[model samples]
Target: MPRERVIFLVDVQSFFASIEKTADRSLQHKPIVVAGDPERRSGVILAACPLAKQWGIETAEALWEAQQKCPGVTVVKPHMQKYIEISVQLTAIMESFSDLVEPYSIDEQFIDLTPTLHLFGGSPYQAARLLQHKIQQEIGVYARIGIGPNKVLAKMACDNFAKKNKEGIAHISYDTLPATLWPLPVRSLFGVGSRMSRHLERMGIRTIGQLAQTPVERLRKKWGINGERLWLTANGIDESPVSPRSHDEQKAIGHHMTLPRDYETLEQIKVILLELSEEVGRRARRKGYVGDTVSVGVRGARFDLPTGFHRQTKLTEKTNDGLDVFKAAFDLFCTHWDGEPIRSAGVALSGLEPDHCRQLSLFNFETTLKKERLSKAVDHIKNKYGAAAILRAASLTAAGQARDRAQKIGGHYK
Candidate 1:
């Protein structure tokens, strides 16, 4: 027998900006925006409040463009710690509702109410309302939740309908699936990114209904396993479990930075790569793993043309040393680079393995040992005092952004 699932997806609206308003009461009624890179007023807007959004201001736009849209829109720096603290509080609230709560991200979650609805007077709607009201009163952030027979429907309902509704909630099931889900664009389905959407578009599959009705054999012939999977998703037939363990999977560890300005010289570009290498090495060392491959990507500064270069090389041995990562990235850049102005640069270490085993070469053993010692000492100093407590001479130069980046989390205000 198939049991009906009761899944609810909760999304906090403009999370960062809402937290800014809640922390500072005066900003609640104003046009609030949370942005990064305070040194550049033209820096990216991470979040925008409802009022600012009304004026066509949006997240990811330049702050200067936002000000132009809503003239004098209030700008605030992002507080990652404060947001994380509040997310933890929200998690606690969801756990109170049901033991099957799964946190999807910083501002999203899924709660299964199938087994726990009896405790809430046998009404999932009532439980949902209670959670919404309590969060507003306690946390002062508005949340919209979508209810469905499974996770996929719940997510789509929340994104397509619930967030825009007056009640901030929507419920979907077998009876309502056809009218609600079938009419949406095929591209609107989850897991369908830009590339997939264009491929489906070329095949004349424009809407979910068309996709669901297409023959299984035809879809399989077109996309192999992925095509069949898309067909199942379109039909609202998902058998996958909502496992929380998925978050633990780390395939690659890397960091990328959009420069304050373009880098036209090789010396300037390599300096940025070294800074990124340090952070990547620190992260890998913290996790006690080393990568078998190193990759580098450089994005062009010219927005109109929008071109870049990428290269990856296999390492003779896995490494977590800062200097090794830098050298690998530098060699890639030297080999593949065309000397174009670079707007961003990134370094990644992948094909991870535990550091417990060792395979050493007699020739390079001494040099490798020295680099490892230096990396550990630098990591210790930064962890104890601060990331900016010590800096390489190259980072102190005009080309380096390590000082400004040290205080940031994922290239945004900390």
Candidate 2:
């Protein structure tokens, strides 16, 4: 039998919010909001569960406003390390179902479930429900799955499931398109943002059915090439594949940590920068990759503060040595920061290529070899003991704090 292609769009339900609930059983049924403190300039809500939505709370809203809407809303701090750890495990679980899993983000993925559907008794719904139950049981989080003929409709169905129902799985086939997809608002389409929605409204196009039938010329005149793509997606005509173990567009490998409290001393922030650089370098070497551009991001007390800064500098050599990354970050900090209190910091590397294939000057070959040997030795010791087994004096002060934060997520390298 010729197998029919089926795209599965899987999304973690209220990811950050759900993680908080998992950690504390008391938080499971109550309305929860995940965000930074409103007192600081970083008081932005990042994620909220459906329970919070009932009280008019939403992601990206001001924390203060969200509190006003839902006075009993419990606020939880962001623990990205823990979230990423869970994400890594979740990704592995998805890959176990089939090799054709594409990570859409930290909390979402698309899987090609076409060939394997028959193994689960020739029913897409049965496979989807089974997957959903497995994820919920293993990860302690709810995930809604959407199964469709293509990726776009599957994604749309996922979004629709999140907003309208909690069936744990939603299916959208061509036969049920009119009943399931036609009444959806055009704004519900993936590419439709605020400005795009206004443009669509102005054209008197208000529904997915209308968009599917709108003249291509009129759409192209308004949105150019993007308009044509949207039209196809609205009509469930997306042809993109769900590639499982595909090549990634990785320009760099980096890791960053945000502090629970701000530091007023330059010495404190410098120590943090070095730790972050070490993390980024370690990941780079693990993947046998190196990059020439190193970037630093610093968050101040508030958005209006001039101290909030981001700076990137090119490295003198293509390397993943911790010292090289630290040098770049130090240069960046010296130029952009003025010893203002630092709330958070992150480091990244870009302009990446395979380490073995990277171009290197003949004169620096010996120096590079020495650095690589030293890095390997350090990694061996840390891998055997812990990340804090051997740390430079510069990062000693911030080591304890960093470990404590990463512990919340049970740190896993992806």
Candidate 3:
């Protein structure tokens, strides 16, 4: 018979805020939050420390709202690069404990400790405590640990039990699921969001225990495979492995940005579109992939009324060139744009394949070759010097966002 698997999901507490506090000792005891600048249309709370949480400051709330909630709260701008570096260090720490380590997100990771638990006194709780201590000593961050036989249970144990507990560690098993997890509301389950929870409640499945008891056939009929998956999750069954390469496969590559203010003219909106397309193309080239499908998405400034469209077009040839991507995206925007003031725009590429060779056009063979060579040279220069080392003349115009975007990671200042 095979032995049970031991998986742990570790989450850093107030990740961004914690890092800021660790860097500056003076802010250790004060209520602090990491937020984006208000003038940039990114004035949202990204992370809040425990002290800040006491005043009901929550992530995703506007920075102004958080200040109103806690008048003395200290707001800090996010440093995405620093946070990413610390995440890499945390990954290295986990790799020392187990060979199977998977980063679930910037602040959460899963490590399979089944084989290495014996080295840590054969106690999952004690092993968690030691791991927590090591992270606290080396990185100065508190990590909550959830131990279970599968990833779902581990995640639940961490989010629902461990995070609320004083010891910062919790465990769940098949035998204890009835008492530990079933009493919780169905919405509290891992994948059950507000809509799913409402649906489950309407079906008289208000608690995790009720959802678990519902017949699989009924759920399968309602949501197809997703419903069955949710039922399995409620029953504490997950077979997905903690693979490190889970994020390597790419179905699509896209970049989206929220503008600082409304862009009313076609010329201004097209500039942002070209910049996004260029970014998407650059990423595809870096990954050595060529895509034949281009998509454009636009959202209007007015939230009260519906005014946006997402459209895609297929090209005759696959390419990783920024100019080619921009041309395709520009065509899509011209066709679908409704002349409304756009507040956000995005570009994406799909239908991808390896860029091992290019299909040379019969009429434009020389031109294609020259463009490819030029792109290669530009990529080389940008890589060696910096992304801003070379730029299109349009990028320097008032309508362009490349210069400002270059200083940020994921729409936040780095």
Candidate 4:
């Protein structure tokens, strides 16, 4: 008989908030929230502890609203470096259980234990309980694990059932699909978002059981290939491999910043664009790649009527130099900008190629050489001294947040 494929999806509950509680024992059994910036009461909540959930506190809502929900709730800021270190440790632990481990996010991971169960007491459920216990003992946080025959089922079980149970573990298989999975609302399915659920409801499919029974032809006629994928998923069918290397391949390197204050002027916006471009260039060079396309994204400052702009430009000569990327991104921004007050902006470099190989352009030969040399010097200084060692003249202006960002990991405080 073929080996049964057993996948485990594990999630760290209220990750940032839980980390805060772990860091300080006083926060235990209290309603706590993680906010981007407490002073900005309008800032979005990143995470809310289980106690906070009782008052209907939610992530991505304004902190002020969360305060309204629970007047006594405590708000904490994120510590990205600590979270990242813990995530590294968690990944190491998961790899001990199975070599086929993939980190879906900092707080979520998937591990396939089908072929490796014999190494760990010959039971996947036993392994999950052991793993969850280990995380609690080592990291001082709660973790829930869901076991299933595939990634989708594992994730669904983790989110829908395991997360709510006291034991923090749940299992689902082809055998229990009807009893455990089908009765849930169709929106509870992994691929079905709110908008998709509304559309499915229009077609008289309110539950996963209904969706599974609906004709594949009917769904495909409405949604094309996506409908086929959903039909398979609703029926507990997924054939995708649990490949570990899938996340390592890079399609783009980008950096974005949420400005402390709205950037209303051209000079202010231009400075941030240059800073983001430099960061993107440094990362691409570190990865030993050059890119031919540069893209820019701008989010408007209007809170109620939120809108953003995105545009990209292709370069004749591929380069990873910071100045080169800034020039391209700046041009795109100037061309496509609606001149609206901006709340956030980002720069991305894509269509990557190995930095070691390059084709020269006849039109701008000496200019490109100078830019490459200058960018190399900047990267060298920053890497040796610190990211703050080298900053453009524009960054010295009042609009600059470069100095603040240098001390952060992923734009959150260290």
TM-score of 4: 0.87
Clashes of 2: 2
Q: Where does candidate 1 clash, by residue pair? A: none
Per-residue lDDT of 71-118 in model 4, one digit per residue for the tens? 999888889889989998998888888889898999999999988888
Q: What are the per-residue Cα lDDT tens digits for candidate 3 across 141-184?
A: 99999999999999999999999999999999988999999999
Worst 10-residue lDDT window for candidate 1 reads 240-249
Stretches off by above 4 angstroms in model 2 are 1-4, 37-43, 245-248, 254-276, 295-316, 328-347, 358-364, 382-389, 396-414
Q: How accurate is candidate 4 locally (lDDT)?
A: 0.89
- Best first by lDDT, ranked: 3, 4, 1, 2
lDDT of 2 by residue, 1-414 (tens): 334578899999889899889999998899999886454467788899779989999899999899999999988888877888898899888877777899888899999878777776578888888888889899999888988889888898888864357576888887787788878888888888888877888888888888888998888887789999988887888778887645476866777666777777777877888888888888888878899999999888655765678889997778898879988898898888876787778899999988879876899888888888999999888778877677777654653355543333323221
Instruction: Give the least accurate 10-residue stretch of model 3, judged by summed lDDT.
Output: 352-361
Tens-digit per-residue lDDT, 66-160, candidate 1:
88988878889888878988998998888888878777999998888888888877766788888898889889999999988888888988988
lDDT of each: 0.87, 0.81, 0.92, 0.89
Better of 1 and 4 by lDDT: 4
Candidate 1's TM-score: 0.79
Which model scores highest in lDDT? 3
Against the true structure, what is each candidate's TM-score? 0.79, 0.80, 0.89, 0.87
Badly placed stretches (over 4 Å) of model 4 are 40-42, 260-269, 297-309, 334-344, 354-385, 409-411
